[model samples]
Target: MQRWPVLLFLAWVCFLFFAGIGLFMSGFLLTRIELASSSSCSDPLVPPPWERQSLPPGSCWAPQRFAKAVLVIIDALSFEFAHFNPAKTSPLPYENKLSFLHRLATSQPRHARLYRFRADPPTATMQRIKGLTTGSLPTFIDVGSNFATYAIQEDNLAVRQAGRVVFMGDDTWEGLFPKKFFRSYFFPSFNVKDLHTVDDGILQHLYPTGKHGEWDVLIAHFLGVDHCGHKHGPDHPEMAKKLTQMNEMLRSLVDHLGNDTLLLVAGDHGMTETGDHGGDSEKEVNLCCCVLSKFLIPPLPLQEPEAVPQVNLVPTVALLLGVPIPYSNIGEVMAELFSGDGDAVSAALQQLSVYHINAKQVRPTVGLPIELEKRRNVFLSTDLFCLVQVGWGHDVIFVGSLH
Candidate 1:
């Protein structure tokens, strides 16, 4: 071949390779959705607290149920690990380990609530954490960026609370919310074999910070369970050991927390039988959310426990902490947590009204405002009287789902 022809062929190959790389990068960048933040407290899209009559309709604040909150994330805590099944004569190694949660739910029925927390697909830690904080679902492509997480741009629970957040464990959090926490003790989370470093680091600071009242929202993300799951599948003896450690730590933490401090224990995601997660398998998606506080009322126990979306934790935490709901939140305020005695009708109506604000915040993205309006009107016209009579406050939230 002539030199000129050989050089031309090499040039063409390089051009094609670069073009393909450019196209692949562009595809992910284009499909990646970045939601606009609510920005200022005065933004029209933000909702005012239920009690503040002086503030306009769309303003900052929501009813604060607790003066402070401590969110403990036990990574990869599957429902089976946390839920106790009386029917199972022979339980697995991971099952019935976190028995304290069940005991708490039974002993303090009015003060504690437990739910099967269901995660959206792409249940990587970073993605699940994003959903847990932002009240938004993750795209499938987001899993690719699990290790290389960028700071979350959208208005999130951590940023809403801002300088009041104290965090430790899972350096992924630092990557996800850089400079957001008032005080932080980050431990490298990528080493699956080394579990105790992150968990112990969190323990060193978690209770001391909570006792001192230096933070309005204390966040501790434990990685031992997830690390154990990754290193030795959920069937291993190490899994039981880790869960027992978690149970003991939780009991001590509960004793340490004051009545005014709300403690939210959540699993960002779960693992499969083989201890792999990323996909949308039932075992992978089903996790646990145990909310403990003197400020809450437990829902009536059902034959089969109901599951709540993990993203719902965002609005639930935001409202419980008296912060404005994020602009992109799709989850409704969990009514079971907010239900109380008093003027039942008035309370139901007041809670129902928050759905209108939720609906408005989400309306712009769904692109079916007219249809949503028509469906909402139909619900109001047909079921308003029935809903009021029966106090079906949750049904009103279903109406907001029209968006």
Candidate 2:
């Protein structure tokens, strides 16, 4: 009886052992299959040499040299929307006190430059962000496939901002730059009816990011302004509240940022007077772009207040952070921001144009020589920087207003 029990126990052990081996083999095979399927012809991690083009001599991405950056994107912020001059808009004394953004831009040791940015319409959030980040023109096809998920195959500035990049707010960026950030917090962009939650949700992470000091780039995309624009027009009661929140947050961010870190704030696109977009009306296409850095020379409105194309920022930010311009970029670099050697600034622009031509990415009106000429002009000018005129490409009455 004892021998029979022992034999039964031995049989059970053998069964368990076989089951374990089978599980291990199955797992091993699945992993191999998964790896095979996921593998790409060109690994983004280790791209081809041609794809990794060199920047100009001194313009390579070195966050160590420039310190890290904090990009605050306030969606649908128009020229008047962010205006805090007290001369314009209502509610008089109460609003301007909270509106340090007004003082920040206009004050001495001025860290801000407010510009009327000309955005490409279909000025939808995705399209604007694509232009802002990739420095590429998003076409009719992009608008047609706005909802579709597309992997970013072209060289992007994110590759330069790759390590330790933290993103919060506006889930749209995740789709725009999938698998890119080290840590991210994405909230629903569609929930416009419930206005405050998305902005508030992103607010929690803001100071903590400043405290930790680990992230090389901290991107905070506030959706409150856009949500307010959608749910209630620019003049709605809630809009004031939202602006107050943004103002407070901006002050906090300024306090928290290291001397090395640059603070860049801009709208993805502007809202119309009636609070809607996707048209070329001055209010809709015209938005504000502001950059604050101790390294920057004072006298806000950097260049006598002219309209710059939204795509221009892609190379501007990349150059500041020591990254190559996105390969497909057609916009000219904002060389005026740098007080460095004009030769190096011009060289960076030339390199960017050359790379675009080599990669065959220049499109429509802007060509390599046209881009290089602007660079050369900026290079040659004694005082005034060269200005490359921007071309327009949007239907006048493109979309029905949200109103």
Candidate 3:
């Protein structure tokens, strides 16, 4: 009888042990894996540009396009708000609110390109920001960590340009970069009820800091549109007022921009019909990205805007500023930013070379089978970057040569 009792207790212990192991394994498997590779400006693996033969390994291949760049984040500025639908006889309050953007894109087609910047869901701000900077996709599990802002572990755009970076608005940047900026102005973004505090805070520092010319890259994140969306749905009168304010602010910012500067405006994510996000609904994922500069000329004239993956921004921004692309970036340089007018072949070659470096950086971690790796290596070694012409066809024409 006593031995039976002992056997039962042993069985119970074994059950608990196995259950604990299973539980730990389940939790470990469920957690999202973060990429940990870091890249420096001097990495020898990245090849020098063909024309820029004297360039050292990992040295910036393309000449810097702009002396300065301004990145503006208008949270929750959806496609509906950015695009003015002509077909609707009576438009919603949120519709046609950003007249300035549409007008500029139409009037100065070469200078301004508006795109439907599609984000990987869950479209919460933090995850979107991660995707924007790191060029990595987020798992659904990341949505839960929206409130808990952790420092970015991977190589990011901000860190690569550290000390030369200036940041304003959205304290989330403060959390993610943490002393990475040369100058920073941050406001609490948690209070959804108050809209002006963050916007006004950005307004106070935005122009003055830009005029100071102390930084290379200026990042300003505006939360008014998003907060208004959260407090009152996009259809409300208040939403119209908020968007109008944004429109005016953008106009003023453009006036302040010199020819030497490039202006990049993007919505981190869009809101649903009810003005909530963090889901994969069409409205929530379709946001706006506008790149404007006196020098910029797109491959196509501004007609209806096209959709682009959000990750592409990282390489585009990096190359525009003459910086090394982040080591783990999986995105290709967006072709629309370059003009194919007289230099289509050169542009294609530059893009292919950039892709080759990006491929070299990312391939080791993907763990392809040995045979596949050999084939990929052979293809890369043989200047098969030219093969992109055959594979991409019409797409390569728009990618303006960097050399």
TM-score of each: 0.78, 0.67, 0.78
TM-score winner, 1 or 2 = 1
lDDT of 2 by residue, 280-318 (tens): 688888887777776654232224636788887876677
Could you tally the backbone clashes for each prediction? 0, 2, 2
Measured with C-alpha atoms, the lDDT of residue 28 in candidate 2 is: 28
lDDT of 3 by residue, 190-307 (tens): 9998888999999988877767668888899999999998989898999988989989988889877778789999999999888899987999989999888877665573454357
Pairs that collide, model 1: none
Worst 10 residues of 1 by lDDT: 383-392
Candidate 2 lDDT: 0.63
lDDT of 1 by residue, 290-364 (tens): 988866653453443367778778777776666677765667666545545546675665566555555555554
lDDT ranking, best first: 3, 1, 2
Q: Candidate 2: list runs displaced more than 4 Å.
A: 1-65, 89-98, 143-148, 159-162, 298-305, 340-403
Would you list the clashing residue pairs of candidate 3? 347-400, 347-401
Runs of candidate 3 exceeding 4 Å displacement: 1-30, 45-52, 55-59, 86-89, 140-149, 301-306, 339-341, 364-403
Local distance difference test, per candidate?
Answer: 0.72, 0.63, 0.72
lDDT of 1: 0.72
